[model samples]
Target chain A: MKENKCCCSKKQKKLKVVNIGLQTFAESLRAQGVTVAQVNWRPPRKLDSEMKNILDDLL
Target chain B: MPVKKVTVQQNRYADSVTLMGILDAVKKSGKVMLAEVQMGTPQNVEVMRKLGFDIPATVNANDLVIALEAQTNELLDEAYKDVIDRLDRKHTDGEETFNSIDEVDPADGWNLCQISLPGEYAAEEAKKAINKGLDVFIFSDNVSIDEELQLKRLGDEKDVLVMGPDCGVGMLDGVALATMSLVREGPVGIVGASGSGAQEVACIVEKAGSGISALIGTGGRDLYPQIGGLSMIKGIKRLCEDDQTKVIVLVSKLADRAVMDKVLTFADGVKKPVVAIFLGADESLFASHKVHGTFSLEGAALKALELCGISCKDFEISDEKIKGIVDSYMKKFSPQQKYLRGVYCGGTFAEESLIYLKEHNPDSQLYFNMATKYARKLDSHLKSQCHTLVDLGSEEFTIDAPHPVFDPELRLKRFRQEAQDPETAVILLDFITAPGVHEDPISPFAKACAEAIKARGGALAVIASICGSVNDPQDIVKCGKELVDAGVILTGSNHQSTLLASAFMKALDNRK
Candidate 1:
């Protein structure tokens, strides 16, 4: 809890964000004049262990 | 027809939109055993697993995009194909993809990140954002206490603020975040572990003609011994040090005993004036220090305002006023109608309404289809007791459907069910407005109530309270008008609505 560790963005600078999983929250951030990049996020497919291990190594 | 399962990549649509789509697909594409569709977010996959889909615990964001359990593999495959085709068309309309947070760093000085994924995956995602150096505000509910602790501990280690997993509402620097109301910006900053409490104080501050400097949500569990009130502590420090915020307000409707004292001790350590509202219970612990603790939401707002050198009248519902409304509605109840049925979208308001009702009749028979610490739970959420409350946003209701607060469609059928009951004298509702929820929740709700009353010979008293600021997309004032137009009695706040209902019930008893 340091004095300098504050996020009152009004006293600081513009608050940019990368929004994931929820779209509306990101949109709300945008409406408030913040820069936001929304990622169309989805979990990885439920690959079987064999496929998962292969994909894990391949990636 | 054999049950077949399919998994696909999640769509970019809002969770409600995608859920509604899957349900619609199920209804239309008949002979379906099961049709649950959601992004591979850890939370959603878990839900799909509960619906008997074979989704595992280790599912990742990029893994099985969507999973479906249907009658036949052939039929479900077709359904999955059709949905993916439609969603792909919807999402790929010239959209760029970011593999991870590291790839698409927002150049606008990415200060904070808001994660609304399911709690199962929320912490992992939050850690990723924190590692990349960003403060986190999580709107996702049901995150485990251990996971929340881990996230906050990591946040502390990284000098990041982790807001909520089931965080209710929030506003920072005058911008409305997930599940929050807008207040005029001024000198005071707020840190709330409860959404409804924070919104109430903020709205009162606005009405008192004072304004807020910042409004923060420290996720509900932040005050627990395990979490150690980390987010609220951080929020207090940030607000106190910030040059813009002169007064700091802390709100939590419920918190553990050990944790409560810890918060008070911390607040006392701060120099700025603080108004602490641990509502439904009173504490005189902070009367001497720059901290002031109160019981009611209005008192908290007034105290905060008073600290800012402003005086405001309490918007309490007087006995005479409650009696007046009760007297007016007394004549409308039929001889057989003797119960008050409450259907709410917010858990806090549902409990608040129940608290007021119990105060009116301590022996009253109240039941609810919710996870409440104070009241008895109904045998079935579908069944109603004498005085019943239903939190329609419960995990059970939203497992494969949209939230009633966000989509009124799920609650539409309950109106018919309750209205048809001969004993249902009153039907109470909480209409909410914010991002992600439907635009006109009250209008359709009003229509349903009107239809039910009309069908049941107009014996029922439909009462409602709309929670949100006028700045919301579904304006409360406008929705209140719609409710009034539909012959529904609209109260000002959730607490006021409860008092009105309680008084009306008392009047009914007196008529005997």
Candidate 2:
């Protein structure tokens, strides 16, 4: 048999995940026993067009 | 007059799922007649004002607004506390949460980032993750085409994978992600643009005793002329390179003509056997290529299984069996019952059902809300025409609320409305079970179906199909049993269910 060389296939090592956005997604991964880092992500504050453009350039 | 209370938490942000959870907890308290928890976006603030709440003008999208209406001040305070407690409990669940992707430790060997944020913020976060050399699976929808192209191009340049902006289902290394079935790992790999379409194929593959190597999602618009099937090409190449994948399956609705030719030509060069199902496209397009083109999702799964040296015999229903079922249903249908109303939680299932209805019953007037050449567009999605098949998970129905898969209230109401119509003969439904969806999605509908049948004295037929594996959090066998007990006809697959509904409609027409 050929060796498993898929992008996800790394010699039988488990995948570590960084889950952003929905909390249930992290919970789902936890239930499956996969190691996960949950990120408490929220939308950035709404900015007007001019202020946003200025910040975009400055950043 | 009812007492109304409003609170705006400054500079606070919560995902839609969290806010919906808080709202559910508040409503369950039974102390308030009206309760709403939403971000203070301009549209939401306007809605709050229309509902007779005095929302301050300073409230912005970053604020968390909770509004409640109770009979007394005491009850109002209690309901408000329940919302706060639920929100606090969510925050304090002891998961060691991070603030952003930048905070994620690179030394932890994290291989992937799964994003489900709002579209406006998703692209930026995805870019950050891609820059970190982590493969991204974006579950958010509404991302602009230019953003998707830019992200895919960046992914190519970085030598990483970008799955979707609206991609909902994926399985990598036997691990299911966001709304996918828990199928065992094996030789067949899938690359799909339709969430529910891929899900149906995965569930069917598992049910037939075969398994999946991976199920890669390429968002919905990956095959458009502008996007040009970027993720799909990447997904196909990855699967082809994977030694575990022996057969590859491609599932999507019809794509742009030039893009379809390009994708098919690319597939023809791959060393592995490929099965393609472009739902509305003719099979002749695959004649010149080495790809095996199928017409239905069930056919796609069975064909993939056949390529892997496995045969599945139980997926299709015989014509004799169909005739018997149709005869039984015709006896119960009243003279006034003449149309089929398909209410579906899975968009792809609805699309497949519409295609099947068109192919089988071509003369029947078909209507849908989604874009399809087989059916005419409905004037308003809220209203269904004759022989209407509506994808309740479409954006129009989900703009203000969660998808029907997560919240069944909208679909339940639509089911009841169709049941009440005297001209409705058969109601076709598709129930999808996943990790994050409602725990017992079918029980509420099963109870409603029982009542509808009793009120009509068993004159209506409700046929349905379940899309999930036994490994899913929801018990598939139990769901099937509940549907059967409620006098609903359950089939082996969505194609079988739609075929049964088409048979019932034709038999009714013959009697007329």
Candidate 3:
């Protein structure tokens, strides 16, 4: 529900990140009442660029 | 108790002219403390012996240098290790009474297993994990494909998951109990060919207002030609099939193009858009629902978000965006330039530069080395290029050393020679910075680059990519500011540097 101005322009918008990280990060998300899902998989085979994007989406 | 002179310039002695007179004065001085003298440089050490001073038998110049560096590194390792060791001990010590199935029973706590056991023993390790009903993380890389296939199957049968055979880094939930950051609850699934690659990707995602579903380190083996992404395919498929995953991004330092093609083919069928970034791949061949061609490791992360429709508020200042903007800007700067001379620290970035140039002007000769042992070893299409992807790691260029990251002086000198040549119009450089990186990377890199640009009289636009960690105290932004201030427009990552340098060539062609 928090709002901030967009960097692209000056329009204000809600800040959001669904759930991020494991325990503490998850707890923070839950405190904000964000729904969380546990994903079971090995880390990405490519660890540099694309991996971060996937992580960003999850957040 | 005497401190050794390690500086480049030798300490000044009074102009008494005689070495003995200086030694006599040294001995006469009430402040002279005779503990041990550490002779620093090979040149200085030789001069010291000629002066007839009885240098210690134990303190040779090489030994002193080695000891100093090793001691410093050892101390740092110990400090970080102390943190990890204490945390791991606490997690282990508390496990006797902790509750919950998702959580490791405090009694059965801290199953930190080394994965280098022989095949039979490895199977036994998997069996033990199942018997204890523990979550397994594997960190060894020498295990064969067959061994991995067996171990993975066993974990599945036991209804528990195994992390890696060569896996070193992952964050399970939010407990960075094992790795530095342990685990946080986020939606990103990270896969990498290199261990450091995984670590870097995770750090960036964390910095950019996101977290990870899981950060998987597949050891370098999964991307090698023999395995061809089979395990990686499994890992990716699992993430993509998961209802929790909104996006899957793949990162790797190096991979076979054919294997990458197969992975992409599979990716094309996924409901979630995949961001496939293959390092050193020609941009012309990038084919995916959402493909990002990047040379440096960080570019893949930025492009993945862009492809996923999650625009960063500051993507403009992000490394990739900056490189794109600067490349376009440079394209406008010089419209008549033809040939380019690129000096890059990273091997993969160098190849991408050549690829970008060819795309712009196929007729203009592009020179670099992609050093594959034989012609038949390479795909026919890749064989046509003369640009050598000179692995700075190889002993040929990395003479008298184990690491290329430590020594950039050799390449900087060669870059200067290339700049003086009349045919060279532009210089592209891939400069990287990170912890335990080259000494004075920004200044030395900028100095060499400025010299080249000045020699060409502003015709040469030096484009650079800073590949250091975002969390690094001295990250790419600071490095870029320094480079930009020095008259060289620093691109964010290697991919952008290549693209911008190539775009400049394209702009030149349009003028002609």
Per-model TM values vs. the true structure: 0.79, 0.88, 0.53
Q: When only chain A is evaluated, what TM-score does every model earn? A: 0.62, 0.55, 0.31
The superposed Cα distance between candidate 3 and the true structure at residue B418, in angstroms, equals: 3.6
lDDT string, candidate 3, B1-512, tens digits: 22322222122111111222333433343333321123244654565555444344433322321111112444434333433343234224321312212333314233322233323334444445544544455553456677666666565554444556656455433333123232234556666655445555555555455656655455566666666676566557657645445566777655777777777777777777666556546566574434445644556666555655566556334446545654555554444345555665565455455545565567654545443421111133212222222334434556554345556767666566656655555566666454344645677767776766676666666666665544443565677777887678665455556666656565554556
Tell how far residue A41 is off in model 1, in angstroms. Answer: 5.0
Interface RMSD of each: 3.7, 3.6, 21.6
Model 3 chain B poorest ten-residue lDDT run: B8-17
Residues A1-59 of candidate 2: C-alpha lDDT, one tens digit per residue: 11222254434556778888888888888888877887766667668899999999999
Residue pairs with colliding backbones in model 2 are: none
Winner on DockQ between 1 and 2 is: 2
Residue B145 lDDT, candidate 1, scale 0-100: 89
Q: Judged by DockQ, which candidate is best?
A: 2
CAPRI-wise, candidate 1 is acceptable
Q: Give the best candidate by TM-score.
A: 2
Better of 1 and 3 by DockQ: 1
Candidate that would win on lDDT: 2
